[model samples]
Target: MKKILFAFALSCIGFISTNAQSLYNSNSYFGSSSSTSISSTNSSVRYQQGYTRKDGTYVNGHMKTRSNNTNHDNFSTIGNSNPYTGSTGSVAKDYSVGAYNYGSGKTIHTGSRGGQYYINGNGNKTYVPKRRTRY
Candidate 1:
């Protein structure tokens, strides 16, 4: 029993380590970084040498700055803002979503024994049963 348990544990650890290295260290999958280049002109978004300077987005067929890192206030330019209700102009912001971190959503996890686990609607994580084949 001890030997079987130890083998299982080692197998799980090996699997996880290999997966992590593949995901994070595999530059070949994402790109070599130096081989990739990007350029844009007459573009709503602007970047200089990979560093983004400004970003604009089109809404309702009109281009507007998506960034609020501007010099002046928009108190007078309310007509040119996003979700611009004509009364309150440009809405340049990264809005935070208001919701619970964990609710009725299905949560996935790895079982302690190295199998897959998923959360039940009642918020309890249950391990998935391993598949068995008939002899």
Candidate 2:
């Protein structure tokens, strides 16, 4: 009886571990950055060069300065100073929104994991993935 219980416990542990690994991979696959290149436009660039961490993990995305824009809807503008960051802006920004572009939204928020997302009309967070730019 002891041997049978031990075997069952080990099998259960192995099965649980396998499921955990699959779940981690599915969610963290994009966390492993593989981008390469620098953007030269004032417009928000999708992917920048990624760097490997001390733990051999790759972190993607580069720091970008706040863009200058005059769109009243944009919080970065002068009179429309960002309520979150309290930063003012100018009169030159792209005011277009595509199916996947979250920057064009009235507000862009950072996720708990440092991802970019926007609040949809339904009051749900819509995470925007970093798109790969064609070289």
Candidate 3:
């Protein structure tokens, strides 16, 4: 009878602990119970409502936005760190090559493959080929 009582007690404790963990993860935030995100081709927004992780890390409630040519202050850019991930941006400040100040107002922009490029008068990406190294 003593063995049976002890077994029951242990089972009850286990059940209670399991339920408590589930409850905390579902209702309380140290990690996400649920999350929402909206994204576009050029922009995105994420809302994390105070989630707690299983590893004991606490994620505070916050909203993140990424957009092109935004007028508001952007913390995800160079010289700033992302509040959620604590990662810093890597682009240099002088990344922009600027416009061709000769006469036309066409601005120079970085291309997808890490090449210096500018939109030609034909309205297309014209990548500047690197100088060939002589053998």
Candidate 4:
């Protein structure tokens, strides 16, 4: 009799657990997740980490200008530690081609004719060909 009662109780508990549902539902999440790294065309050091969702876009990345190790210094970089984070549209604002030079009165543009331009002051648009950083 005791064995039968115990088996019944165990079955009852198992049934209750099976019916329980998870508190956190995946439907509550916004914009499924899509993450990727943007690689530099010239070199491998420059990369961007972020997500591009069908609903919205976000980017966060870094540029390696300087190395953390001082003993094996072959090159020096700037703003490697600093991060760029914002909507994908934010890149447009940062890389304006028509950056007006209030002092020069001449507008500087980046990218080719096929590409759009946004001009910004203090925007140093320079590119250095990628090369071997290590021997």
Q: Model 2 residue 83 lDDT? A: 28
Q: Which pairs of residues clash in candidate 3, taking residues 3 or more apart in a chain or in different chains?
A: 30-51, 30-52, 30-53, 31-51, 31-52
Residue lDDT tens for model 2, 1-135: 997996686566556645644654453554547353321222321223578966699986442334343233444433334322346654333332332354463466655655555788777776553222225
Every model's TM-score: 0.22, 0.22, 0.23, 0.18
Instruction: Tell me which of candidates 2 and 4 scores higher on lDDT.
Output: 2
Candidate 4 residues 1-135, lDDT tens each? 997996686566445433321211232332236243322111223332456755476654433323322212112222111222221221211222322222233333335532323344556443221222223
Model 1: weakest 10-residue lDDT segment is 39-48
Instruction: Please state the error at residue 70 of candidate 1 in Å.
Output: 53
Worst 10 residues of 2 by lDDT: 38-47
C-alpha RMSD of each candidate structure in angstroms: 25.8, 20.5, 19.0, 21.5
lDDT of 1 by residue, 1-135 (tens): 997996686566556644653664466766787455321111122111223323454334322333343312332232232222334533221111211122225444545654444677666665432222124
Q: Give candidate 3 regions above 4 Å deviation.
A: 1-63, 68-72, 93-135
- Evaluation by lDDT, superior candidate among 3 and 4: 3
Model 3 per-residue lDDT tens digits across residues 34-100: 5643111212444447889766999886645544443123444444445445676443222223212
- Candidate 4, residue 132: how far the Cα is off, in Å: 32
The weakest ten consecutive residues by lDDT in model 3 span: 94-103
Question: What is the alpha-carbon RMSD of candidate 4 to the true structure?
Answer: 21.5
What is the Cα-based TM-score of model 3?
0.23
For candidate 1, list the clashing residue pairs, or say none: 78-89, 81-90
